[model samples]
Target chain A: MGNEYKVQVNHLTKKFGNLLVLDDISFHVKENEFLCIVGPTGCGKTTFLNSLSKLYDITAGEILINGMPVDLKKHNVAYIFQEYSNMPWLTIRQNVEFGLRIKHRPEAEIREQTDYFLDMVGLTKFQDYYPDQLSASMLQRAAIARAFAVKPELLLMDEPYGQLDIELRFRLEDELIRLWREVGTTVIFITHNIEEAVYLSNRILVLTNKPTKIKEEIHNDLPRPRNIADPAFVELRRKVTDLIKWW
Target chain B: MNQNKNGTKDNKKYILMSICSVLVFLFIWELVTDVLGIFKSTMLPSPVKVFGTFIDKFTNTKPDGATIQVHTLASLKVALSGYLIGVGIGVPLGIAMAWFRKVDCFVTPLFDLLRPVPGIAWLPVLIVFFGIGLLSKAMVIFLSAFIACVINSYSGIKNTRMVHLWVGQTFGATRSQLLFKVAIPTALPMIFTGLKVALGASWNALIAAELLASTKGLGFMINQARGIYRPDIILVGMIAVGITGAILGYLIELLQKLVMKRGWRQ
Candidate 1:
């Protein structure tokens, strides 16, 4: 059986009491695919990611990884949230190693992965600093480092750079692309920024507003080291913005 | 490392000011009782007189039937016994109650009942049950410390950020792992706060219990001195309590620093 997709969502429905948030949404993410979910504000994008990560129980449907039901114990999934959930008590290096340590990786592997990710994120110098002591960009990088260090089968990012300035966001988006290429892990990134989705994703999933459903799936075939000012990039961004634009 | 060079200099200045303030206070105390002789020696002894009695306490146990060291050691024994036991049980129980519903259901009712009743109010009952020896006094201290520790620790674990726990869960951490690795470390500051609060409560409760009904402790020494009209001995006992409490607080800070340094690396 050829399981070409890494993640499969079958009729993913979620409701809060009587209010339906994700309305029988279904999607697929291919192996090592950088899929971005973009929508208007309050469009249940976060709820979709939470359901995929199993952070919230689904009201009805099922989420699958490698064609099997999403079994958390059997498969490792890493997440980078908007809040940058680095443990305050841990240093940057320790925070990077948090998931690896929780998974009980070997000491040598923990040290190796921690150092590699820390260096890749350009945070080796600040590895000894706590999360509170670092800048907003640095904290987000530390979170990315922590998520990548685990070598997860799938990674979910919920607008991880939403709080950063534009410059920091661009720099981090490049680092995220470098990480995605190097590790080749399946990623489902949620954001409302049309440019960001066009810039980072190999495939973009556009979602609608309340009673949210898939609005469009934009496949981005731009060349690597993407130039956002490039006409094709601008064209794709305009297309995605048109798909989910409420205002 | 959190402090800068300017911060270090400011800290030194603050230390100097603190020293000067204490000296000024001592001078004023000496002025009224010794230099001006405004108060009788029996009413409010001079600093010199208190110092003399503090020295005399080592060699002479005439007034309180025990040396200052002996009284301090006895008080320490009762206070620390209750303090360690209270914190040991209270912290884990609090964390458990917050993390697990079964534990919360079992302990919260008794906790609510005991929290309102002051530790001093239990002295008569404890004294009647266990007598005025170390057991009853320790029990009195236990109630005070336990309530303080439980309240702080419970809040500490309860207040762990939801996002942090989600991070752990997304990584497939077991409940125990989440509690220990994420929740407890996140709760470190408040748990230490619980420890400090419990220490203060235990100290105060021990003294009250000893003052009401005990033969040998700093509180008993002060009470005996008051009966015998030895103001100097009373002053020594009071100073002893203050200094000891400060030292215990410093020790807790030392423990906090060790835990909070973020050096427990993989």
Candidate 2:
């Protein structure tokens, strides 16, 4: 049996008491696919990710990874939240190595992965600094490095660069793409920024407000090293913006 | 290097100011008692006389059974033993109560019931069970410190950020690993606070315990001074308790600095 999809969300529905949040959402993320989920503000985007991560128990349906139920112990899943998730007490190097250490990887492998990710994220110089001492962008970079160091089978990012400035976001997005291409891990990134969706995703999943359901699944076939100023990039960005525009 | 030098200079200036303030206070105390004769010599002795008694007690044991240093050491032995026992039991018990529902259910009701009862109130019961010796006094100090440690440790573990736990769980941390690695580390700052509170409480309770039945402690010395109508000896005992308490608090703060490594002074 061939399982083409790395993640399969089968009729996922979630409710908080009587209030419905996610309404029968179904999607498939191919192996190593960079899938961006974009929606308007207050559109249950976080709820969707929580359900996928099993942080919240779904009211109906199941989330499968590689033809099996999503079991955290059996499969490696990583999440990068918008808030700086670096443990404040740990140094940047320790933060990067946290996931690997939790998984009990070999010491040599842990050191190797920690160094590689820290270098890739351009944080090797500040590896000894605690999270509180670093800038906001640097903290996010550490979070990214930590997530990637584990070599996760599935990576979920919830607007990880939402608080970052435009220039820093672009730079980090480039680093993220580079790491993604190098590692080839399936990613489900949720954000409200249409340009960011068009810029980073291989495919964009647009969602509706309130009880969020898939509005559109637009395939993005743009060339690598996408330019925000490029007319083609602008066109795709506008298309996604139009689909999710509530105002 | 320049900043370091400036910091040292500022620290020295603060210490000098603190010493000057203490001297002003002592001068006022001397003025009221010795110079103006506002209170009787027996009621309020001059600062010089108190200092004289403090120095005399170091060498001579005429007033008390033992010297001030020996008395302090005896009090410390009882206080520390009980305080350590309290920390040993309270911290792990508090963590368990916070983390596990079964533990909380079993411990919280009884803890709440005992928490309101004063440590001194237990003196009679402790003396009856353990006999009026070092054990009874130590048990009293233990009870006082134990409540503070348990409450602080419980709140510490309870207040662990949800996101930190989520991060650990997402990374495949086992239950024990999450408790030890994530929960415990996150709870350390609060645990330190608990230890400091417990230390002070134990010291305060030690006075009451010593007042019951003891021959060699600052509290016993104070009681003995009152019986003999020697206010100078009482003053010396009070000063000794204050200085020792301040020193112990400072030592605990140092331990907090060593353990946390976050540069949090308070």
Candidate 3:
């Protein structure tokens, strides 16, 4: 059971100057688990996620992926941020191929994976368009397609749809679920939206306010094609919101 | 279809207006010099006299000892050599300065010290070191273009989006990969801006050096005409300089368009 953990964070601590942000937080994400980390706004959720993604150096503690310290050089980790991070100079197709090209994957493999993901995200028709030429939803879709194209061992998403409208957000959330199920990679999705966490995750990690710690880890064994309007969904979301004491 | 026809009509109208404006300006200039004779010919030669001198100098090399074409070729050689060399070195140095802290620290003090000094101010020192030859005058232009290219390229790389860098880092790209794949391409528009500024500076610096010390070039031709008191030749030389500068600027703009036309923006 212990060996099955895909990601292990042990006493993750962070401090910006004298003010502590993440105080000795520890958690373990299981293999192929869609773990949603929901926290109150301004509760250092991004800081925690950034640390986990190795974008920021944690002051203390360690992040382990497949039972080793996080090393981007050795591990395949992909990240989708709150903002559109696609290189504006590259077309949507080139953006999707960026990581694969960087890793020097075989040409045929790169083309195959790129086409599959771009088609999967419904961006096949817009492949030649630049980022500025695309709408917000398409841009985010490009980011998702780019992340999944690498077939990452671990995928990190940080409020990737925070800027989208509710309709677009739901559409992307569903696509993310489909990708997660198909790829079966370990997913760590960070968001402040409780309903979003409930709607997408296999398990939800509820975080406390500043100097954040894991308030609770709830198992979300909700069946497929889960309805957000369903009573069970609303009740689970309420339970997470109640834990954070934030409406 | 109507909108397209109207747009074409508007463009033609603008072109016609531009031609008319130049004609009116030349008419006014000719009137002040030739028709009224209010100002002496030496001070401001008539447009007719200037145009005659322009054509005559193309064939005749009496005053400057070199035809207009020869002077122009010489000037192009100096300007282009200094300009290209500066871009080749300055662009890479600037990018390195921005991406590497050690390089930035080592080079910034030298850059800051030289930044305030005008490129023309280096002419006397360069003449002393290399004499009033192609090397010396080109060195003056090199300094001017170098500063511009470095400033722009450095600022361009520095302006790379942090989010883009993170994307590269997360995807397991190395430091050099982040630079080439992410930072440099992202910084391209600004780097082009630097190239444009560098071209202008190099041209201006070359002219100043030629006016003060060169034995050839449009600037030297103007200086030689000034010595012989032939305002016609001077005016022609000035016109040549203006036309050449505009043409060079247009060429740079064309290059910019060609390089950046990867459908970067609408």
Candidate 4:
């Protein structure tokens, strides 16, 4: 609980050729904190997340994890892509075990970890099923299960539920929050949905359109077992929505 | 519902009718040739005689007056050997070119320069260097099939999604691991597509090689029939080539399905 300041970003700037994607962005993610970033479409939220994970080189900035530089070779980071990220050739169980296998964990440990996550995500019955055989919600669940099973120090997701419908999205969102709570891993989630951002995040960071800079930061002080119908939840959604809508 | 079912049944009936129509045309061909007696037997043998010759040759141990099994086995050997060599070289080269920008730039112009010349056009040069033997025939096939495979394999790897790469990178995969596990697996469907096209090209090249220079093979058999003025034998050879090519292609399709069944859904 005390390690909540696990990730710190200072003056991060990223550019692609002549175009600037992120401008002077700075943020801190407390350990075990669910930090959600919301911006208008193409506001460079994804790029910012990528920069934090070192998927993209920052034009100017520094990111620290646990009081040290974020070295990809040393620290473990997992990204849950927006769409079906599981390889079609691998089954549900195998997909969940892919990262562990790549990291060359022992066979016994891999099997036990895979089985545990498959059950955690309610996909134990479909362990042998391929990505194409699963429904969209189920595939997302499998992907999330895969990312979490790696036990990453920091989990980065790029609109993981952006493609899903309202009902499935919310259900998966619930599962995600549950997983985050149980694992207590630092999370940085990116989305354009104001409600989803407010619903899942303990803190929200809003950014302006491309050549983007942070527009606002809001702390969601809502208690656990958060009710979407609560006034505070509605107010937070409204504030985030207004920031993007007016921009 | 009944009308839709009936419509599908009628579609099948239509196809059957179309086939019968072709048979009827052949029947008229036989009748006209018989009644008119317009051509000599040497010029255009009757369909009955050609078919009879085909059956006698195919079924009997010594009907065609030549050792067809020897010819067939020779041709198969040339085709399979050339095809295997081509795939072995082309698959890796293609993947390398696509994966590395420097390699692609270096090799693109060379391949482009060599690709336009058909395999047959190289026959004279090959004959001069290797003579009219198995090596020359295999060379023709290798040249024809290699280009097709390289292009397909290159495109397959080139088009791999960055998301998959990022997925691997974020998971702490080394450069080699990412290339082999993510890029190669993702590119497999296209690689098979290339192999299928290359195989078809290999068959085309075989005939071209045999036509130019060969001691024994189906291509040589067909060329020999042409020189001896035996139209029936020519027809048999033609049928043999067509049937064998189709059968080989079918087998390749089955093999592709079997080897790739795990990832077939994508």
* Top-DockQ structure, candidate number: 3
How does model 2 score on DockQ?
A: 0.53
Candidate closer to the true structure by TM-score (higher is better), 1 or 3: 3
The CAPRI quality class of candidate 1 comes to: medium
lDDT of 2 by residue, B185-265 (tens): 878888888999999999999987787678779999999999999999999999999999999999998888777875222
Sort order, lDDT high to low: 3, 2, 1, 4
Provide C-alpha RMSD values for all models, in order.
2.5, 2.0, 1.3, 3.1
lDDT of each residue in B115-193, candidate 4, tens digit only? 8998778889999999999998899899878988899899888877888788888888998888898888888888999
Candidates by DockQ, descending order = 3, 4, 2, 1
lDDT (CA) for every model shown?
Answer: 0.90, 0.91, 0.92, 0.86
Quality of model 3 by C-alpha lDDT: 0.92
Task: Give the Å error, residue B224, model 3.
Answer: 0.7
Q: Which pairs of residues collide in candidate 2?
A: none
Rank order (by TM-score, best first): 3, 2, 1, 4
Regions more than 4 Å wrong, model 4: A1-4, A245-247, B1-29, B32-39, B55-66
Clashes of each: 0, 0, 0, 3
DockQ of each: 0.52, 0.53, 0.75, 0.61
Compared with the true structure, the alpha-carbon lDDT of candidate 4 equals 0.86
- Of the true interface contacts, the fraction found in model 1 is 0.65
By TM-score, who's the top model here?
Answer: 3
